[model samples]
Target: MAVYTQVSAEALAAFLSRYDVGDLVSAKGIAEGVENSNYLVDTTRDRFILTLYEKRVAAGDLPFFMALLDHLAGKGLPVPPAVKDRDDREIQQLEGRPACLIRFLPGVSLSQPTPAQALAAGCALGGVHAAVADFEPTRANSMGIAQWRPLLERCGRDMDAIRTGLFDRVAAALDAVERDWPRDLPVGAIHADLFPDNVLMLGDEVTGLIDFYFACTDIRAYDVAVMHTSWTFNARGLNPSAGVGAALLDGYDRSFGLSAAERAALPVLARGACIRFLLSRAWDWLNTPADALVMRKDPLAYLARLDWYVANERAFA
Candidate 1:
């Protein structure tokens, strides 16, 4: 959720004219994520989210994302429902960009999640996997292992500017992960990105899982690994000291049992998760425009996570 594309009141009003969501009262740009242009739209009827798909997100993949949300919402998952227009189209064009209005989910995202939140997030993630088990749309993870090497090459020696030997460390981690990447694990629709900010909570209950933009078909345990790295670790992305790593995994196991292979591959999957974010943050740190509405996250945070994962692989057991 960012504001790469600015929406004028008149333009937004004209856009909303196509929908029965009522006249737009106010719309404000949300400045959290780096992918799409998001605006909180309030109307006489109800509140909603308006997202203008940015270049980072492929236009062709929009249907899969919209349909996935529709499917999950139908299953009673706490996710936003994709609001369709009068023509019954889930997506529309605004300012020459593909856009959609999603029902505004209730609750706020946690910055530093509590152990209880972690436990609930674990259960919620398992439910997400189960809910989407039969979803037929398949979108390959654009940020998965296959893209790591190319992402590294694009970063090239500039990563050394962030820290000495940073490029080599990331390259080696990529090599190790790709070489030993799991081949035969439970695969299905995984959220792929379950960061703290993506999970919304009101009190102890997780009200919604927003941002299905990174959702894809992949190893289910890899989703657990992503959640563990994001939720259990400290803000600095080091020291999985929340003591919720095991508890989170335990929570997931109660819903969908983790296989021996998934357990054994946890370490590498986690390391790959670290690399995925590190490279992304590094690239955004260097390339994202200074005036962009999105925040530039520190690449070093994921670097710390990578180090911790390497040293504490045994702890995941």
Candidate 2:
């Protein structure tokens, strides 16, 4: 939701002209994402999400991510379909912004999901995995553990005053994760950022998933762990109740069951999962400009998760 790219009103209207979408009726910043500048665009004909990707989203990788979403939707996965433009392109320049148009899927985001809704998000994730596992295009793991090493190296200073600082424990946990991470449970493509904001639902059933910026070739369970980070946590960002984790785990297990070894690995993966988010939150905290519309998602939440892992380390790692 950060307005990184400065787009004037006139410039936005001009970008709309390239598409079949007639006459931009109204356009305003749909500032709800940290990675992209989004405008909920209205035209005489319909409503659309116009995304002006931030630097975090590499321009080269847009096609693969866009195609993957379309592939999943075509297979009946609940998600928005990328709108191909007049030049038969999925992405176009909007106000000097490297942007793309997408058909908005209908639904409410499951902020306070029911057991049914939480469970469905789990099921929908599995369905999406089924739909996307074999899609051939590939991209770098933008938010993966491997990618975190450099950031952690640069930003891994002291945070000992904090009750939930993971800076000390994470170094050791990361080593174990790197060494023992599952090599062959099932690997293909996965929606790496299946957070609540990215998932849309109508009532208890899911409608679609957005924000494939983090999708990549990775271990399936790791993706599950990544998703579990958001859905499994409460407003305070700890597990809301044990039942939340159990429910989400149950729903995911229904789709992609885990083995005894995989189950043994789940805690560590979940810990790894926490660190992954902790690092990203730390990065955003350190880097976000004050006026940025995007609120920095809390790093302390993940740090608290790390402390939770250290205290109750047995269940997961």
Candidate 3:
């Protein structure tokens, strides 16, 4: 959803020639996200999204990512399907980076969601979990609990620079999460990063659920925990409300009931979610160039969220 790598018109035209998608009309960088270099591509025949997989994405994992999209889309989720080229390939090399094209989906992402929208997001996530029930492929959660500490360690002394005494607090939280992280919740393929920007809406109606790049096998409830942490926070990161959390859980449970264990572990999982994002944002904040095509996110935003979750673990219940 961002453009770290630049693509020229001639290069794009050469790349488009390999596909039967038609002649390229225009290509524009999309600067919304912090991950890959993305562009909205318009061709004579259709509009598609071109994503240049950056180093953050492992090349070995591309097959799993693409196949999962095909599975979810085939199962009738609102996800965009990856476009295949004339060779029937979902991936190709462009500018020496792994890239792929996906059919452009309608609807826009919402910054702040209503309770009804929260309900729809919950239902959509639940539906994704159900749809992938029979999908044969499995990829481990690359950003799962085990990786958080290492991410923090990589952040190292740089974290203290972000906020005095911030490293210790985050380290303490990471340790606590590692100690109490759940083990036996129902396991399935999950859309691990379901932030509001990843969900698309047409007014109050849920129209699309994009970005399956973070999909992996993990506790289904942990996915719900991501939703709780992401969707329940208000603007300015001051007010973390339970009403949205309640509505989301209510909607999800209507489709897939949560186990006693899942419910009990939700608070800890919410803490883990906060830790995951905080570490990632902090890492990006420290490493990514200020003027990079990608907008570096503020780690303090998630730092505030981590603190909020620590104080209001019961709110996620």
Over all chains combined, what TM-score does candidate 3 have?
0.97
* Residue-wise C-alpha lDDT for candidate 1, range 1-317, written one tens digit per residue: 78888989999999999989898899999998888899999999999999999987888998899889989989999999778888999888999899988888889998777777788888899888888878998989998889989999999999999999999989988888899899888889888999989988998899999998888888899999999888887778766654678778877887667788888999999999999999988998878888889877889999998888888778666
TM-score of each: 0.97, 0.91, 0.97
Better of 1 and 3 by lDDT: 1
Which number leads on lDDT? 1
Expressed as tens digits, the lDDT of each residue in 1-317 for candidate 3 is 79988999999999999989899999999998888999999999999999999988888899998988888889888988888988898889999999998899899888778888888888888888888889989999999888998899999988999999888999999888888998878899999999989999998777888888888999999999998888988644557666777878888887777777888899899989989998998999899876678877777877788788788767644
Please state every model's RMSD to the true fold in angstroms.
1.1, 2.3, 1.2
lDDT by residue for model 2 (6-50), tens = 677788788778788888888777656578888788899999988
Clashes of 3: 0
Please give the TM-score that candidate 2 achieves against the real structure.
0.91
Clash counts for all predictions: 0, 8, 0
Q: After superposition, how far is residue 81 of candidate 2 from its true place, in Å?
A: 1.8
CA displacement after TM-score superposition, residue 60 of candidate 3 (Å): 1.1
